[model samples]
Target: MALAAVVAVTALLVSYREVALSADGLRSQAAPAVQDVAATRLALLRADWEANWVKENLNGVPAAGESYQSQLSAADQSLSRLAERTSDDLGTINGLLDSYGTSITDGALYYHDDRPIQDQKFREAGSLLIRSDVGLVPRLDKLQNGQMDRAERLATMGALGYTGWVVAELALLVLALTLLSALWVLRDRCGRDYNPWLLSSLVLTVALAVVPLLAMTVTQRHLDNARDKLTAITTVAKQTERETKVDTTDARVRLDGAQTRVSKTSQEVRKELSAHEWQNSVYYGALGGGILVFLLPATGIGRRLNADYWRAR
Candidate 1:
């Protein structure tokens, strides 16, 4: 029983460690990579739209012109790929992209004919684009963020699970102690050779080890599956950003004031991601360490006591 306890405790420790490491990997590295890619994509897409605005409102200079058209084509390809990948929310994004394409097409035609856009018309179309953008793009980004939040929440719950395991282990220890005490009373009462404390301790040891180990294994597996899903979402975001970047570049011209604003907004998003990653990493690390520390004594003492009982009996 004592040996079983030791084994169980060891298993618990290993499980918690794996979960912690995985969380750290996600918060410190994986999550940030995903956010960075998404933010970059958002920035580029906004830039493209801003250029469209500038071409319309600014001195008859079309921001993207032929280059912008080429970029839009690439964007179309990217959006198509995204639609293929995201089987779940394809409809919303596809519709938004279609609307965006139409707007771009109309805006480009107006620019080609050198037709001065009325401020009101520009505002209306711009509002439509904004509606399409905030409606779709941010939601996509939010989905990714939502995964991260879930992971963080799971990690927190895992800690709580660890605490429960600790209590179970302690209970096993107490039970073992009670058994050992009973053995002593038996020997005294019957004039027999029995060590109740030792026998009881053995049971406690097993309980301590088995319960925590099992709980940890199950929880870690859950975390692993969740993290994998998060990673998949990240991959999609990265692919989209890479495709967009292939066709986007900074031009020497101001193009549109809106583009500048988008750049500023993108920068803000980048900063937010950085901060989020840092916060996640720190908290996750602390939780992981706490689990490990809590598990060690609970398992070890029980195992040791059980071993002594077995040897005496």
Candidate 2:
């Protein structure tokens, strides 16, 4: 019975740990990487749109140039953040962005001089930004997809871990019942009241079984909420990507709103996952508590056997 209890406790601990780790990875690394990549892509799109708007309108050069610079800065910041978190080599994307910026700047210079080459420069820059192949946008999209894939894998692992936890809980309940039955048998055979040590072990077993179950329930809820928010952000981003032009104020306003929502949802996910801080404490407590539960039952049974041996002697 003691061995069974130990095994059950170990299984519970391992399973719950897996869930916690997966949740942490999803929250801390994968989710954030996805957000960063998406942000970068959005910023680049807006900046290119601004540049194109200026080229076509031949007016609002000051305002449009300011917006373009601001968007490019935003994209740079997002890329820096992404580089810190991701293992992917961002050198290619960075090089492409630099070349794209140069083309846009040259286009502006040509426009100022009324050079015929202004159109060519703008077209080249636009192609570098949005060409279906070997463009900055496509590269970022590839990175974002990879990050999303990682987040999905982590979420799946957490779910599998939850399933494992349920199995462990069932095993623990069975072992607890078996131990209690054995205790009851000993009490009847020896003509004594219930053993205190074994009784305490039963209480500990109940605690070990119940506490983590509740904690895991809460963790799973948070994980699901985070996943939902991330999906919403992805959907919004894809919608924004489909826009052919952002020349009108209304189009630009919509893009701004979408970006704001993505940022807000990302923040909410981080806040929700932060509530998982208690998982580490619960995990360690379960380890110690499980050992004590095992020891108490063994001590109680050993005492009973020793007493019987003396009586026989």
| Candidate achieving the largest lDDT | 2
Clashes of 1: 7
- Which candidate leads in TM-score? 2
| Candidate 1 stretches greater than 4 Å from native | 2-37, 48-50, 53-63, 66-88, 114-125, 132-134, 137-145, 164-313
lDDT of 2 by residue, 182-226 (tens): 777878876878989889888888998899888877887788788
lDDT of 1 at 122: 42
User: What is the Å distance of residue 180 in model 1 from its true position?
Assistant: 12
- RMSD for each model, in Å, please? 11.5, 2.2
Give the C-alpha miss distance for residue 265 in model 2, angstroms.
0.9
For model 2, which pairs clash?
none
Error of 2 at 147 (Å): 0.7
lDDT of 1 at 230: 48
